[model samples]
Target: MENIEHLYEEYAQTVYKYLFSLSQNADLSEELTQETFYQAMKTIHHFRGECKISVWLCQIAKHLWYNEINKKNKTRSISIDDLEIPVHTGKNVEAAVLQNEEKLALFRMLHRLDEKTKEVMYLRLSGDLSFSEIGDILGQSETWARVTFYRGKQKMMKGRSEWNSD
Candidate 1:
């Protein structure tokens, strides 16, 4: 097997983003990201090379987050107000404000989705993984990942339309 050090350099950001998408807490994400790598290092002997390392790392992160939440026995609400939009896009002030507002609205709607669907959507959108990769990480089929994401997208669109008409 290769050095564990290289794995951190290659997959840290992806793992961090995936964990952040799940927990929506920067500090928790950071801690879990580190814990995920640590667990992987401890169990490196069991890695079968059946999937991409990134996928494996994400699976570890997912499990760690799950265990943490289950142990705490309380759901942590997503703090939309804590989300920051980057300002370097060179957009006009009005455009930036509108963009940020739209993102906030989208996130609020996303939180309304069922836990599994929301997770699929977050992994696809924020983690930037393909349906196949998501399936590997979530221990499901690619078609399942695709359909869940499609349904989630439809729910978001339907919610947005209803809001617009009200």
Candidate 2:
């Protein structure tokens, strides 16, 4: 077997990012990334090389994140009120608040979407995954993933315009 260190060096950031996308907690994601590599080392023999190594590592990270959340009895969705959007308005506190509100509204609009579209948005926006990877994960074609993401964007834009008019 090649060095596990090499594998960790190559894939740690990708696995961490995948965990972060799902958890949005840097600390938890880091811990899960380590755990993911550990688990992958243990099960490397089972990896039949059917999928990209990065994808397999992310699958491990995803499972560990879920297990961590279950242990903490936490919901997948964090409380929107507790979030602080990092949009820099500098000295303009009112502008910052408005920006945060807009981000929260976007989240709400995303939450209202159909499950498939919502998954597409989360994978595209948060996971920073490619359309092909998202399609592979979702068991759909690359074109389907691209179209779902485009449609999801359209829905969010329409919702935002409507929200602004309110």
Candidate 3:
């Protein structure tokens, strides 16, 4: 078994990013990240090593966020600012703004996808999870996760082309 502290060090950011993709709320993601670690610590012994530790941690975070949303009966929308899309252009304000706008547009398109596709994109792009890990988290096969991600990517590309033509 890995040390709890090491697991926190390695997986906290990944878990937080996953929650952020779902909640789009930094404060809530932070809370869920902490809660994820807490739960992991409590249930460490139950971990069966079937999946990567990062995958397991993200699964916990996903469950926590969903359960909270279910209890509150509220839906959270993804905002451009919520994505934390990096736009560092070495002090070029115009470049930064343009990059940010592009990211905003991309996320807006992403929001139009079905819930499962959106989740797959979030996990693949934001959480940096592999298809296998995503499948483990979503309770599907890796092929399904890969196909969903590819389909979502194609949709995003089409959306981008339409936006550009407009």
**What TM-score, over all chains together, does every model reach?**
0.61, 0.71, 0.60
Local error of candidate 2 at residue 132 (angstroms): 5.3
lDDT of 1 at 113: 97
Question: Candidate 1 — number of clashing residue pairs?
Answer: 0
Model 1, position 131: C-alpha lDDT score: 86
Using TM-score, give the best candidate's number: 2
By TM-score: ranked, best first: 2, 1, 3
The local distance difference test score of model 1 is: 0.87
Which stretches in model 1 have alpha-carbon errors above 4 Å? 1-17, 20-35, 44-57, 63-91
Q: Write the per-residue lDDT of candidate 2 for residues 85-139, one digit (tens) a residue.
A: 7655567878878887878887999998999899889878898877887776666
**Candidate 2 similarity to native, TM-score:** 0.71
Q: Estimate, for each residue in 31-133, the C-alpha lDDT of model 1 and write its tens digit.
A: 9999999999999889999877888899899899999999777766658896876656566777978988989998998999998899899888877777876
TM-score of 1: 0.61
Q: Give the Å error, residue 14, model 3.
A: 7.1
- Please, what are the lDDT tens digits per residue for candidate 3 over residues 31-109? 9999999999999989999877877888888789879999776666777887975546677878888887988988899
Please state the error at residue 129 of candidate 1 in Å: 0.6
lDDT of each: 0.87, 0.83, 0.85
Cα-based lDDT at residue 74, candidate 1: 75
